[model samples]
Target: MSTPAALRALLDGRWSDLRERTRRQLGVVELPPHGLDRERHREHVLRQLRVLASAGHPSTGFPVRFGGGGDLGGSVVSFEMLGFGDLSLMVKSGVQWGLFGGAVQALGTERHHERYLREIIELDLLGCFAMTESGHGSDVQHLRTTATYDAAAGEFVVHTPEPSARKDYIGNAARDGQVAVVFAQLVTDGGEHGVHALVVPIREPDGSPCAGVSIEDCGEKAGLNGVDNGRLSFDNVRVPREALLDRYGHVAEDGTYSSPVDGANKRFFTMLGTLVRGRISVAGGALSAAKKALTIAVRHGETRRQFTRPGGGEEVPILDYLVHQRRLLPALATTYALHFAQEELVSTLHEVLGGESDVDDRRQRELESRAAGLKAVATWHTTRTIQECREACGGAGYLAENQLPQLKADTDVFTTFEGDNTVLLQLVAKGLLTGYRDHVGDLDALGMARFVATQFVGVVIERTAARPLIERLVGAVSGDDLHDRGWQLKLFEDREEHVLDGLVRRLRAAGDGDAFEVFNDAQDHVLRAARVHVERIVLEAFVAAIDRCPDTEAAELLERVCDLHVLSAIEADAAWFLGHGRLTPARAKSVTGAVNRLCKLLRPHAATLVEAFAVPTEWITAPIAQR
Candidate 1:
């Protein structure tokens, strides 16, 4: 099960040169020993962050002038690689470099950048992103914290208007942070401007809270104790007007609020959109965690002897069992798929945030929708994959040294943070629906008539022509290759299109009723459409990456991995395919059989696949996995 040197080289080249070097450097760091003492763990992570910062790792995504390489993709790749080690360190680093520092870089004006970017990048000034309030986690618009413009003093008075307005679950707020990028409602004599971000001093350089700012440690959690999560309340905490991170919107010295974007809602959304890189980073980190969990489980399965042969010979490896392959192989395939999807996400993020592309509003919305959907999928997958890996390892996984327990505990919150998975899916669906409406709305009178006619024709063609077309195409290919890339892509695309088309029809049928009620009724259907769309995108990325492989043997092996991923997805939702007539009952049954066969085919490569992750032995300190 040893990976070929050629394949190892190819896998190593998957990330950029900067990321490869960062990964190698991270491997050499001496991590603190694992324990349950939260305070001690927090200190450990803080020390680790300092180490990473000293290594020039945290500055990858910032501007080159600010001691950063200005390499967004490389930064995310490094973050993902770091996840193979201590997740607490990974998260703490993300809070410092990704969320807090990224907020400053992405949202701040040039003056703010010149003043703070270098110091933040160098870890000279620690900060937190103070956005999620006690009453508002996902819903940022309604945050009860207010930043009132004081015209006479030329200051913005930041205050938590109510207890619910307190910034909760804020990383670095408890101990390390000296400043915070606070999101609050902006009020001036002109009007109540929507949510805006301001740089507010949370603590002085002496590690004490600044005047009018009260901080409370959010003691103990399900996991990630190393990250110092805390709550902060502002009691008329006034900051200079220049503290506003006014890339999108700003207030004048005379208390006049203005923005490049006309509407308050648009301005608010534009501001929030700047931080989408955080979502991408989270997804990549979650994928990395899933890979580590699978590596541990698969490696354990490869070596752990479970049952005797029929003739009472030596015990066989657990991986030799069909059930064990079924449990772990598909997950491994999914890890690969997620890896490819995350790469694409990182690239897109770099394009938008690296200032290399002129991304329009439409493109930005599309990016946000995709990031939201993929983050939801990837994090949920991590949670599921880790749980399965834990169970697959049996009792040994429960042991702390095996790392699965800690992996499971730490990744559980990933599903809710960044954005709640459920809410994010809804955002995807909303984006889809809005885009669809806009597309139709853009048509002229004659074009509208033609569009309706075309839609009618499309429906007729779908009902009458699509099935026979697919069947004929399937007939041309060997039944064994039904799980081939072309067919799998078509299957996923068709399923997503079908779900979206149906959702649109259902919404149209609702017809001028209470919009909220209509949306509520279709929420489940909308979520399904979003999930299907994201699955298709992930599958496409996986197939494309496999196609790019130059080594024949490597390509063939990756194709099999892709087969496992696609078939497993098909098998999981077999009932849906069958009910929709997309798959005959016979084909549906074959999907299950195909998945099992692929699992068996891939079992021997399990250890090799995980080894290609190149996790340092120091990072994956799981004893059972080591054996």
Candidate 2:
């Protein structure tokens, strides 16, 4: 089926020009053949980085004054599109331009930008983001690397006080990086300040380790070998006072630490929040990878004929089977949902980082929480969807030429990095609870009265399992239109609100108890709340995007895609809906049946859906898919 021009335009997302330019750029670039040799892969990625730099691709997000385009969202969208070709190259570019360069731009002042931004953007000086340590990946506040101020010399001496303090799994550290943005505790004569970023030279111009700096390659991993992962330990590494990325906090010449933000924890979190772009970019990249995997797998499913019917002259294509449709179509639908969610995420990121709007603290917190949750979900979705796509293609997918193995292997670490999914979910839950508390705290007399009334109703429902009554009333009014977008959204929203309400009550009841124990017991509940909230966000974003579509054939087709996403999500969580009496057992079964029906409806559009991603034929070079 030919892709509708309208749908094609929609699929280009917010950064249409940038996405098309990148797709064209990727189409023209010559990439190395897929391989297992880490060194070769590393060189291939480095070569691609040079190609990208020459093409001016890495400078999109940087300031135009610093030899960049200064298009934050466009840069990320372009980076995401690169995921279609080589994931290792995508990651390497992200490390160079997003993580390392972004840290400098977001955290540093004019002095640092003037000194390094242009060189970094041009790839003249490769760098590493030395934040994650052996002992602390997410807990930046307690890192053991210390930078002590030398008032006499106007320098800060950076040292890894213990083995665990060594920065580990630092991309570009093993091979290409000449400098690093090292995060360490800032100590002076007065007292120790919390974590601060300092630009320190790790390797000399000739690629040899600088004095007092030791580096070791992290060696082989499950995947992404093209990007050299390494560890660094500092033995009294000293950088000038001006080396500090002091956007948030700064040390005086007299060794007194001062920050616009009064508190240590606040300063640390605010600084770390600047890197939310990394998380958002990773989410977009993961979605792109999943789209590529689905494209290849679905195309193969369409062409690869399997078991012949009895006494039949020809074998039917595997995609004709219900099982195959079930495996690939729902994933395709989810890819759509993730795409829309990622678009919204990128927009929010642009607003925060693009200087287009005022980003207050609350907005920043919202953006961070949403980015963390979406990153977790999108990466986890990519990992699972790629695995399923691989299995759906059977033996053919296991081959490197098909690219599923590469996609699977590369995206596997996405969940662990940025932030661990589990920890991120907890962060989402914490944000939810904090927002809820603030809401209640700010209630006036009229609001408090309304809240009390709502709580009374909630208590009655919980005490009596009143869901059946409400279900009956709704069922009488609407019948079996549960697949309706509004119904689907209400179902998701209700579940999330209910779960949050219950979790909040439980936590409040545990007052004065062991806080850790209380949290430990409620971990599962908290995670469920986070998952439900993220699902709601994804659903709303998908529906909102669909609503914005112009009246065209593509819009009609997208409505079907949106329906599939809603039904599939509902079907996956049928047990929760049934348990809450939001869906009867019969209705729950109908949800699955509806999903199967939507799969059949979407089967014919599978090829078009994937093609709408506009991945170049060269990037998707699997033979079976090509056929």
Evaluated at residue 188, the lDDT of candidate 2 is 93
Span of 10 residues, lowest total lDDT, candidate 2: 457-466
lDDT of 1 by residue, 23-101 (tens): 7688656666767598888888888888888888887788888888878777787787788878888888888888888
* TM-score of structure candidate 2: 0.93
Pairs in clash, predicted candidate 1: none
Model 1 lDDT, residue 521, Cα: 83
Residue 312, model 2, lDDT: 79
TM-score for candidate 1: 0.93
